[model samples]
Target: MSDAPIRVLVCDDQALVRTGYVTIFSAQPDMEVVGEAGNGHEAVSAAQRLHPDVVVMDIRMPLLDGIEATRKLAGPEVVEPPKVLVVTTFNVDAYVYDAFRAGASGFLLKDSPPAELVAGIRTVARGEALLAPTVTRHLIGRFAERLRPADTARPGRADLVRALTARELEVLELIAEGLSNAEIAAALFISPETVKTYVSRILTKLGLRDRVQAVVLAYRVGLVTAAD
Candidate 1:
């Protein structure tokens, strides 16, 4: 929101890819390319050193993978972690959920348009989790079968249900369903600001880093399902 350009660190194994990202990001007047990382190890080290507002990370890399690097930079134990925006190819869509679990704030397909990638970085920089509809659908389709079992009484369900009010639960369900704050407000007949308040409360109560974790928890607790 401030005039300060959003600081970004691009991390990938391929030189060409990193160069491409730098070019695109540098074109944005509101964004700054603070640094670059060739692998996950360098990503973590560089991120620690640069403290960029957002990290553009590739899921596959040498030494440490992007997932582990994301964890090191933004995991729950981290203090004041920078937001991570993971970029993946179709072959690695299966790792999408794992990246979110590892503390990624958002993800984009490797072939995503330059505009989309730029917007993703901005979204995460603003402390928003960017789970596009296609990405969410892919996540459910890829892992839903394994996530579901006949028994729905998973551990931590009771605590989660008890921790949130009915409205907060509804908001969480909408979040898991991939609705934006405006969409959730429309669906619930509440103002967008009100929806945001509910979201903040939900995150605080759940101790989640962001809405990505909220969605994962919703699936893990049987609150929202692939069928839904």
Candidate 2:
């Protein structure tokens, strides 16, 4: 990581909640709270003006919603976008799934421990996607039904087979299974560095931004399913 402290912007609809996030983020040595927004419109404006490295975004807000704000900040059309870490109150929120589709880099419940929140910011700042294990398992699966329709037209298993090597397909399947680099490495009897290389290759070949997209694609194409 860079020696510079990670710059952050916190956005929420409530004053007390925003302040709490500000206080928690400000206390971290490696983090700097650059700005705060009480709603999504302000979040987009603040993110554009301040250019925070990571945006701690809330889901529901007045004027605009966090999903749209995240899209404005980190959507695929953006030339260069900050990492967006979406924090919400509900674990089963469909908005969280939409946030990911809008290009959020991470997702966390508002009730997540301070340490997890801090770690989430750090992870996204490093250009890594952060989804808690439970979120990966339950949240994604819970919304699988809703996602299937939009995903039905996406590239299917045959496309994936043609586009990737057998080993790369294995790596993608393990990724969709929510395994970390170390876990995948152990499972395949390969080094973590090798797994990292495979992941990078998979992302490049598939034109995916991160593991979240990879997981989504895996499910969409029937390479893996929530049931599995």
Candidate 3:
């Protein structure tokens, strides 16, 4: 790991919110506000130029929405895309799902406290998905229908399933069900570090960006259900 502070690009349509984020991140020893964008278009442009480790993206913005910006910045098609943390509202639940699908590393409620927002940025920068149990459930509950049942014979299904050891498959299910690392650890009688290692191996084998993508793929592949 580099010794530099985690570089962050803050994107929000509102100036006030941007200011608040800037203030919070600037004060953190582990974080630095490398750039700021008031809208999605600017966000994409800045990301290209700045190459920040993480982007704090707002869902609704002029010129381009955060989802689109997220796609351009962190979509699967992009090579070495930066991590994106979406900040939005419950009312735009569909957009939140789209943001995740667009390759956001995590979602943060717009009204989340300053501490949470800071922690979320750090989490993503650490290459971890910042999905709490509640966030996971909310995501699955609200957007489960959007995920079509996986055709078992789809291009990567067999490969994905075969790539995991039985233990990894079990961990994947717990993850899809929205269990945090510690929770999954307790349930499986394993250490949190071990759970994290399983998660890392799972992501590597499946070519997933983070746990958010892991959860998405789990539901898509029928390893875990929306009902769970």
Residue lDDT tens for model 3, 19-111: 999999999998989999999999999999999999999988999989899989987678788999998876466776788778888888988
Pairs that collide in candidate 1 are none
Expressed as tens digits, the lDDT of each residue in 1-228 for candidate 1 is 389999999999999999999999999999999999999999999999999999999998999999999989987778798999999884465587677667789988999999999999988886667877666756854564454322223556559667899999999888888888889999999999999899989878776767776776777767877777
**Alpha-carbon RMSD of each model:** 3.8, 2.8, 2.8
Model 2: clashing residue pairs?
Answer: none
Best by TM-score: 3
**RMSD value for candidate 3:** 2.8
Candidate number that wins on lDDT, 2 or 3 = 2
TM-score of 3: 0.88
Which residues of candidate 2, in runs, are more than 4 Å off?
141-161
lDDT for each residue of candidate 2 in 1-228, tens digit (9 for 90 to 100): 279999999999999998998899899999999999998899999999999999999988999999999999988778788999999987656777888878898988899999999999988886566886556766666665465323233555347546899999999888878787888999999998899899999878876777777777777667877677
lDDT, candidates in the order shown: 0.83, 0.83, 0.82
Candidate 1: segments with Cα more than 4 A from true spot: 1-3, 137-157
Kindly indicate the candidate among 1 and 3 with the higher lDDT.
1
Q: Which should have the higher TM-score, number 2 or number 3?
A: 3
Candidate 3 lDDT for residue 94: 76
TM-score of each: 0.85, 0.85, 0.88
